[model samples]
Target chain A: AQSVTQLDSQVPVFEEAPVELRCNYSSSVSVYLFWYVQYPNQGLQLLLKYLSGSTLVKGINGFEAEFNKSQTSFHLRKPSVHISDTAEYFCAVRMRSKAAGNKLTFGGGTRVLVKP
Target chain B: GAGVSQSPSNKVTEKGKDVELRCDPISGHTALYWYRQSLGQGLEFLIYFQGNSAPDKSGLPSDRFSAERTGGSVSTLTIQRTQQEDSAVYLCASSLDRGSSGNTIYFGEGSWLTVV
Candidate 1:
């Protein structure tokens, strides 16, 4: 079975400050990783995804994540955040196999609170 | 629709009642998925449908939970005899196909269910 763990339940940061949301996963095989953001009263939007190739994957809103194979971690980072970045962020993992049914296991989510 | 669409953005039902949540995937998406988001459970996969293949129901919590995708486009998640524990956000997502590299899944706003 595969699982995702987000160490921080909430992260607070001021506008123009850098931030990082930690995510770790346990999987028996190679997996695809993703980050999603949900704003207040809105649907989830994809921030980025790591399928293959580069270890550092850049995403929308100037956000990025690095897939560390050794540590089994894919942490999201942003050089600076805005008030509009206040949202709930989720980390997810999917098994990279045809027999795996393409199911996604998600982390507990980290609420990013961007303050002015 | 341009993106995944879910109906009845918010639903309030009493315990022991039956509720149906609907999802409309992207026009050409061949894979659809259902997931539940709750304060206690975060986000969990419930079921998945890909083209005409048998749906993977392994993630369903119990027999009371069921889902169906008609014409490979619209999906409905039915929960019979709902309980307070069933109160959460039911999210739907779709992708072009499963088991492909760099398949990015898009999510709906989700149907918020409240059991009284």
Candidate 2:
């Protein structure tokens, strides 16, 4: 089984300012890391994912995340945020067990408030 | 190509009533998933269907929550005797088969269920 935790419940930042949302996970087996965003009244949209290879992965809307294996962390970052970026962010993990069938374990979410 | 779509975007039901939500996945996708998003629980995996078979239903909170996929296409999630605690956003997603390289899941807008 895998579990994810987003350290912050909410984060407020000025528009155009850099921001980071912290996430950590605990798993017995190797896992995949993902970051997703949810806008008001909308479904979750994949921001980025770290499956293998490079530790740093870039995603849409200038968002990026780094997968740190030893630390068990996958933190999402953005050089500059806009008002449109104010939404809920979730960190998730999926175990490598084929029997799980790609089921995801999600964090409690971090609400991003990009103030103008 | 059309993305995943869900019906009855908002549903309000009285306690002890029954509710049903629908989802249509992208064409040719063989994997479908259901999840629940609530204030306390955040995002949680509910069930998964590949082709016409469901290999995992362990995430379902109880027997009251049930889902079925037919013809390997559309799916319906039914909640019997819905309670106020069942009020949450029910999300549905599908992918072009998971665990393979470049496979990503797409989500629907989700059905908001508010039980009073």
Candidate 3:
């Protein structure tokens, strides 16, 4: 079985400030990583994904994440956040095997409150 | 639709009553998944389907929860005798085929269930 842990439950940041949300996973086999964001009252939207190659992957809304295999971590980062960035972020992982299918294990989620 | 569609964006039901949530995955998507999100539990995988066949059902929280997919497109999650603890947002997603390269799972807006 695979599991994910998001170290921070909530993070408060000021507008135009940098922010990072940490995520770690435990799995016996290789897996794919993903980051998603859910705005207030909206559905989750994919921020980015890390399947293979280029440990550093970028996504929409100027968000990026680095996949550190040795550390078993996939941390999401944004150089500058806006008021619109205030949302809940989730980290997820899926098994690499076809037999494992498309089931994803998600972390507890980190709520970001970007203030002006 | 351009993305996954879920019905009854919000539902309120009495405890012990049964409720059904529907999901319509993206066209041509062979893999579909169900996830639960709550204030206490965060995000958790429930079930998934591969072309109308469910390979795993253990992720469901209890026997009261059941899901079925027909025609490999629409899926319905049935919660029998719902409890207050079962109140949460149910999210549905769909991917291309497997956990292969460039495969991304798209999510629906989710059906919000409130059991009182």
Candidate 4:
């Protein structure tokens, strides 16, 4: 009952280029991946998280993500981007157990227009 | 309140009047969440508190939407009647006790209901 698919709603990069923001998830069991960043009015802010072991999960400003268990995906990169890294990105999922609670399941966002 | 703290950030209400949004978590952080962001659409899973247990409303979207997390950190989301699609932007998050191992879920800069 977990779902998160953010293929891209808007992504216009330029300054410094290099940006990827795609995510997918359907979850039937293990899950816990996140990458949030909303800066217009400001709220969300955790840039990276992938729960278990490494799957390439950086975070903070440099940003990074790469937990692809067979293809459930969890993309969100940023080799270089500036213009203050225009924001509005999200992709979440949570269900690593705990009786399937902790609620998160998000993804319908991906607006990173860093121009200039 | 060094982080997750929301409250009348911006409310307009009038559709039927009955809004009450407020959250204050981060002191002890025991997991508390409630989301709903609609303007562009994303984060919408409203209800979850993990401390005293017994919350997880399963993503409430009806029953007039209600929430409560009292003696364990402070949370109050009530919307009864107010329609207009219930406006939008009403996020509040917290974590550190949801199967804690690194549970990170801090957010709050929301609360902009405008049910005019």
Candidate 5:
């Protein structure tokens, strides 16, 4: 079974400050990673994903994440944040191949609060 | 292009009653998924439907929960004998058929269900 763990439950940062949300996974098989953001009272939107190729993957809203195979982590980062960036973030994983069911396993989300 | 859409944005039901949530995927999307999000909690995978094939129901919490996708476009998730624990925001997502070629999933606004 694939499991994702988000180390922080809440992160508070001032506007324009750099921020990072840490995520780690435990899975024996190859996996695909994703980061999703949910605005207050809104649905989730994809931030970025890491399937293969470059370990450093850039996403929308000036966010990016690095996939560290040795560390088994995919940490999301943004150079600067805005008040609008306040939201809940989730990290998810899915098996890499068709032989395995491509079902997503999500982590307990980390809530980000950006203050002005 | 329109993203995934869900119906009855908010629903309130009594315990022991049955409730159904509907999801309409994006045009041409062949993969649909159902998930649940509780207050201050992470998203929980509920089910997966690919085209017209039998859905992968492994994430469903119990037999009372079931889902079906018709015509490979719209899906309905039914929870029988709804309990207080069943109250949550039910989310729907869809993705293009990539056959493991790295497709991103788009989500709906979700239907908030409250059981009294």
Candidate 6:
């Protein structure tokens, strides 16, 4: 079974400040990683994904994440945040290859509150 | 629909009543999934359907939860004898899997279920 753990539950940051959300996973087999964001009262949207490429992945809304194989971590980062950036972020994992199912195992999620 | 669509954005029901949530995946997507999101539980996989294969029901919490995909396109999640613990946002997602090539799983806004 694949499990994802988000290190932080809430991140409070001022506008224009940098922020990072940490995520780690435990999986016996190769897996794909993803970051998703959900705004208040909205559905989740893909921020970025790490399938099998450069460890540094850039995503929408000026956000990015680095996938570290040794550390089993995928941490999301934003150079600067705005009030609109306040949202819930989730880290997810799925087994690689067709032999495994496509269900995504998600972390508990990190809620960001950007204050002006 | 242009994207994964779910019905009944919000629902309120008495404890012990049954409720059905619907999902319509993207036109050509072959993979569909159901997940539950609550305040503390985060996002939990409920079920998965890929093409004509057997639906992966491993994530369903208990016998009270079941889901089916009809004609390989639309899916319905049924919760029998719903309880307060079942109150959460039921999220539906779909994806066009391309093996190791990578693909994005799009999610619906989700159905907010409230059991009293």
Query: How does candidate 1 score on lDDT?
Result: 0.93
Q: Which sections of candidate 1 miss by over 4 Å?
A: B98-101
Selected candidate, larger lDDT, 4 vs 6: 6
lDDT of 5 by residue, A10-69 (tens): 999999999999999999899999999999999999999998899999999999999999
Q: Is the docking of candidate 3 incorrect, acceptable, medium or high quality?
A: medium
lDDT of 1 by residue, A1-116 (tens): 89999999999999999999999999998899999999998878999999999999999999999999999999999999999999999999988885755888899999999999
- DockQ versus reference, model 3: 0.66
**Two-chain DockQ for each candidate model:** 0.71, 0.63, 0.66, 0.29, 0.71, 0.69
Runs in model 2 with CA error above 4 Å? B98-102
Of 1 and 2, the candidate ahead on lDDT is 1
Interface RMSD of candidate number 3 = 1.9
Q: For each candidate, what is chain B's TM-score? A: 0.97, 0.94, 0.94, 0.33, 0.94, 0.96
Q: Please list the residue runs of candidate 4 whose C-alpha ends up more than 4 Å from where it truly belongs after superposition.
A: A1-14, A17-30, A34-54, A57-75, A80-87, A105-113, B1-14, B17-35, B38-44, B47-63, B66-80, B83-85, B89-114
Question: What is the clash count of model 2?
Answer: 0
Model 6, residue A107: displacement in angstroms? 0.8
Q: How many clashes show up in model 1?
A: 0
**What are the interface RMSDs of all the models?**
1.5, 2.1, 1.9, 8.6, 1.5, 1.7
lDDT of 5: 0.92
Candidate 5 chain B least-lDDT 10 residues: B96-105
Docking class of predicted structure 4 = acceptable
Candidate 6 chain A vs. true chain A: TM-score?
0.98
lDDT of 6 by residue, B1-116 (tens): 69889999999999999999999999999999999999878898889888898888998999999999999999999999999999999999999965542588899999999999
Backbone clashes (count) for model 6:
0
Candidate 3, residues A2-111: lDDT per residue as tens digits? 99999999999999999999999999889999999999887889999998999999999999999999999999999999999999999999888867555888999999
| Model 3: lDDT to the true structure | 0.91
The sequence of per-residue lDDT tens digits that candidate 1 reaches over residues B1-116 is 69899999999999999999999999999999999988878888999898999999988999999999999899999999999999999999999884483598899999999999
Question: By the TM-score metric, which is better: model 4 or model 5?
Answer: 5
RMSD of 1: 1.1
lDDT of 2 by residue, B1-116 (tens): 49999989999999999999999999999989999999888998999888756447989999999998988999999999999999999999998875462467789999999999
lDDT of 2 by residue, A1-116 (tens): 78899999999999999999999999988888889999998999999999899999999999999999999999999999999999999998877665655787899999999999
